[model samples]
Target: MQLLEAKLHKIDRHNYRSYSSMRGEYTFVDFDFFIDTVQADPYAPASRVRARRKWALTDLAWLKDQSQDYQRAARDFIARQFADLSQQENGIQIDRPGQVILDRTAVVFDEEGIELRFRINLPADDRKIIAKKAMNLMTFTMPKIIRRSTIARELPIEEMKRHCEAVEDQVALRKQLEENNLLAFVADGSVLPRLAGNVDLPMANAIPFECPAELAIELDAPHKGKIRGMGVPKGITMIVGGGFHGKSTLLNAIESSVYDHIPGDGREYIVTDESATKIRAEDGRCVHNVDLSPYISNLPMGKDTAAFSTQDASGSTSQASWLQESLEAGAKALLIDEDTSASNFMIRDERMQALISKKDEPITPLVDRIALLRDQLDISVLLVMGGSGDYLDVADTVIQMHNYQALDVTAKAKEVIATHPTRRTSEGSEILPLPRTRQLNRAALKTMLEDGKFRIQVKNKTTLRFGRELIDLQALEQIADSSQLYTVGWLWFQLAQGKGWEKQPSKAFENMLNDDWFRTMPHYGDLAKPRAIDVMAVLNRMRKADFK
Candidate 1:
């Protein structure tokens, strides 16, 4: 601490650039502080720093003995606490987590102690350093915030326990999905609607979800005991309803349930298969070497779709590419909503088939191949459809949402199929081959970084600027946080370090994203663990990427 103060004193009234000399480690009375990076000016990005307190100092060392999930939740809870406390000061900031509890580096736990990674904007008067103000912030305010967040007594003990337990329980529930032959579970009383289109908070006075008795199943959580919820069965399940009837709302909840939500977030008990991917029509997106033969075999001028590559794709082609890419990335279940999907890609009616004969039309819709995916590839699909009754013929389960309530309509849908049978013949081949793994060119990634001076930037959750390429990721609804995107860019940076092509990029990423994923990267608090599927999805969106 004296060292920090002395340096600040020497730089008092000096140019802001002098602050760079203060970058180093300092030993405080109760903890150790590290200024990893220094800002060049007051308006530049905040300086990165870390405060680590030994386990013996914090009565919260018991967290070290907990399960990995429990420990991750505890760390997230601590980071949230620090963020809340630091909000009073404009210059101090931490990477705050959202409703989901992701494995993040904002707060890390090692064998020795708990470390809090955050940013600090050095105090300045115009372009000159303000030594006294910097001293107060670093030596007094920051230390207090660090101690309160790390110490057990300073925290809400019961609230922390509940937070950690809820995450642990959600993890347990998700593990039970495969054994129960389920794709997702929505516990009774979960609030499905958010406050608005842009807001992610639960809406006030919203109708709570209720599982129809026919689809109700019980799963045991270590902390919450048995939880009864709607178990969306494996295979093709359709959610059908009128406009504003909460059909898309239900699908949104299930898609977000792939990650564990914080307590009282309204969907805390809801859980879905971690490998579930939500894919939609992303028109104008780039497609690289994807096999779209099952859905689109023949094209104008005898174009080959077996190794499809397009700089700009149509809605139907983009959707097909996403589906095939998700399969290659090891997606076990797919979630789709008709509102965001391409009509032509989802289905082609008998009238259209008759008007344009199969010989002339080259596109094969998803309706023809959903059953093939379920039976041959062992993949499950949950779709929200209102326009197409054609899917009823192949659906294993049907649910209808009426005025925000769910009703089991599988029997009714079967009855409808019997009374009003469709004349549209299935358009695709009977057998669906598993999507082949595409090798990624590591040289391309490295070249991109080199061309752009090795820069990685994230814009909210919608865009990633890796090297010189700006990739659009607005269609990836399952990315829980922007921090995950930051991790994705760094993961690609590691992959770019190797020479030649990566034979199995998805599997390689899966192996890198294990329990010790963050250990290999720079110690930045903004990094959060991302799913392998999302990592590959981001890479697939990069226009400059080369895949074969």
Candidate 2:
């Protein structure tokens, strides 16, 4: 602590760049502080720092003995606490988590103790450092925040326990999906609708979800115990309803349920398969060497879709590419919403099929292949369809969401198919081939970094700036946080260290994202663990990437 104060005092009123000399470790009375990186200008990014306290001193040593998931939740809870505490101080800031609790690097636990990784703005007047202000913020305000967050007594003990238990319960429920033969589970009382299109919070007076008697199943939570929810079976399931009837809302909840929500977030008890991917029509997105022959083939002028590569793809082509890419990255189930999907890609009506004969038409819609995906590839699909009944023929489970409540309409859908049968022939091949694993060129990633001076920036959850390329990720609905994107960029950086092509990029990423995923990356608090499928999905959107 004295060393930090002396360094600040020595640079009193000096230019902001002079504070760079303060980049080093310092020992405080109760904890040890390390200034890892210093900011050059006051307006630049905040200085990186870490404060670690011994487990013996924290009175929270029992956390070290908890399960890995429990410990991760505890760390996340502490980071949220530190963020709340430091909110009153302008200079001190920590990465605040959102509704989902992710495995983040903000608050980490090691054998020795707990460490809080955060940033300090380094108080400055214009371009000059203010020594007293810096001292007050770091030595006084920062330490207090750290201690309050790390110490068990200073925290809301009951609330923290509830938070951790909620997370554990969600994990337990997710593990029950495969055994129950379900793709997703939404608790009977879950609030499916959000406040608005822009907000992610639960609506105040929205109707709670009620599973029909036929679809309800029970799962056991380690803490909560005996959770009753709607079990969306591992097959072709369609959510069908009228406009503004909560069909999309139910699907949205199912998609987001792939990640466990925080307590009181309305969807906390809901759980989905982690490998379920929500894919939609992303127009103008880049596609690299993806096999889209199943959905599209024999284009004009003798074009081939077996190795489709496009800088600007149409809605149907983009949707097809995303589905194939998701499968290649090990997606077990797919979530689709008609509102955001391509009309032609989802289905071709009987009238259109008769008008434009199969020989002349090159495109094959998803309606013909959805069942094949389930039967041949052992993949499940959950779709929200409002305008079409063609899917009713292939749907094994039909759920109608009426005013945020679900009804089992499988029998009704079967009745509809029997009464008003269509003559539209299935356009795609009978067998659905598994997606081929495309090798990624490490040199291509290296080139992207070298061309842009090695920079990685994330703008919310919509975009990522890696090297010189600005990849748009607005269509990836399953990315729980922007911090996950940060980790994705760094993961690519790690992958770039090698030479030649990576044989199986998805498996390689899965291996890297093991229990201690953050250890290999830079010691930054803004990193969160991302799924291997999402990592590969982002890479597929990079226009400069080379895949074969």
Candidate 3:
């Protein structure tokens, strides 16, 4: 045992805001002293014994670990040093690895004491480490403290674990929301209305429809591709595309999206409209020979007179009546394909077309019908048509089901709109400076045609072939740089039919028709007759004056 004249140095006066620490050199001067000569104080000092930290740092923390009793000796030494402090206010205080400080009887001292000092070794391995830790500590960062405060240079392992857990919880909640399948339905035919109209969200429209971000389904060949869903208005939406292009599949999938059904049946999306009536038809039965009398009146037209029926007595007056009843039944949307009409145009013809129009009165007819259904009934129509049908003329927005899925046909729509000239017409336009109306005026053609330039055709036999007219050849050559010229020829041919007014069908015209205008324009193989016929109808209606 050695005794020394003990002396202490105060290194720092300002106490650390949180846990306290101190340091001072302990130099033991061993000297002779009789065991019986010691004197004790009258009263053991009122101050309690406080746990002391190591003032002098050794060369290595684990230097003593090399010995056989390394762990036991080190632990026991620390225990003896803190033995007196444990009985003080509450417990002992001691430094642990990884910068942990435990207090109370569980580990270390309890009484809150002002920090005495921080020892600095002139040149030692711990100097840099201590300095690094001191520099990293930021004071006054805790918002809950409200005032100035200080924390350890490093955060506690437990606090860090808790912080990471909180962050993970937040991430998990977001993922759950994404997985929640917001589709509108239940197995019982119910509807979970959408929250908003984001294109990525399942619920897109305010009514019942949802704009889908990525809608994909496995279908038979010729119908492989993603079917995108756009936001539908409160009114009808038309999906027009060519045959064998997966239109019906898309419609069926849409129905499935509402209610989760099997792939061929339902179960894709959960639709809550269990009570909602779905009048879908497959094969020919209901679609092929539907009785118009159920919905529209059986008008006594001589051709359809095999079964005598009263027009007034019938619940339905025409094919339009069937559609009308569906609308009246509070049906959200009508999905129709080819061969539904009694008359190709409609039962009431102009009347039916007028009822489905964007507006009423002024338009030839469609505008009026569109206004009635959209404004009054709130029912939407999903019509699938081939070729540029009359319904396309009134459609507010057309979503085509081409390439086996749904696509917005806005480009085609805008092209048709651009062709439709209003009152304003520039002087150099190829499309004639038309009047305000979109439909070509049959009366105007009679006034403009001269006897010499006119070639009349009766019974439509001699009117198929038409030559191409040059329209800004410089632009045409630029566009046809490397691609084929199918589209280019079609455009010029339309111009020729409209302005040139062919007097005779020429061999050159046939050659040009067969030539490659552009590889892109639709191939007219089996579809050639229909394509040719549709083009001629437009040509016959267009006047030479319209091109001027």
Provide the overall lDDT of each model, using Cα atoms, as 2-decimal numbers.
Answer: 0.94, 0.92, 0.28
Candidate 3: misplaced stretches above 4 Å?
A: 1-232, 255-259, 262-267, 270-318, 343-368, 420-548
TM value for model 3: 0.28
Q: Pick the candidate with the highest lDDT.
A: 1
Candidate 3's clash total is 58
Candidate 2 lDDT score relative to the true structure: 0.92
Clashing pairs in 1: none
Report the CA-based lDDT of candidate 1 relative to the real structure. Answer: 0.94
lDDT of 1 by residue, 1-548 (tens): 99999999999999999999988899999999999999989998899999999999999989989999999999999999999999999889999999899999999999999999999999999999999999999999999999999998899989999999999999999999999999999999999999989989999999999999999999999999999989999999999999999999999999999999999899999999999999999999999999999999779999899999999999999999999999999999999999999899999999999899998887899999999999999999999999989999999999999999999999999999999999988887888999899999999999999999999988799999999888888888889899999999999999999999999999999999999999999989999999999999999999999999
For model 1, where is the 10-residue window of minimal lDDT? 423-432
Model 1's TM-score against the true structure = 0.99
The deviation in Å at residue 415 for candidate 1 is: 0.9
TM-scores for all candidates: the values are 0.99, 0.99, 0.28
* lDDT-better candidate, 1 vs 3: 1
Worst 10 residues of 2 by lDDT: 423-432
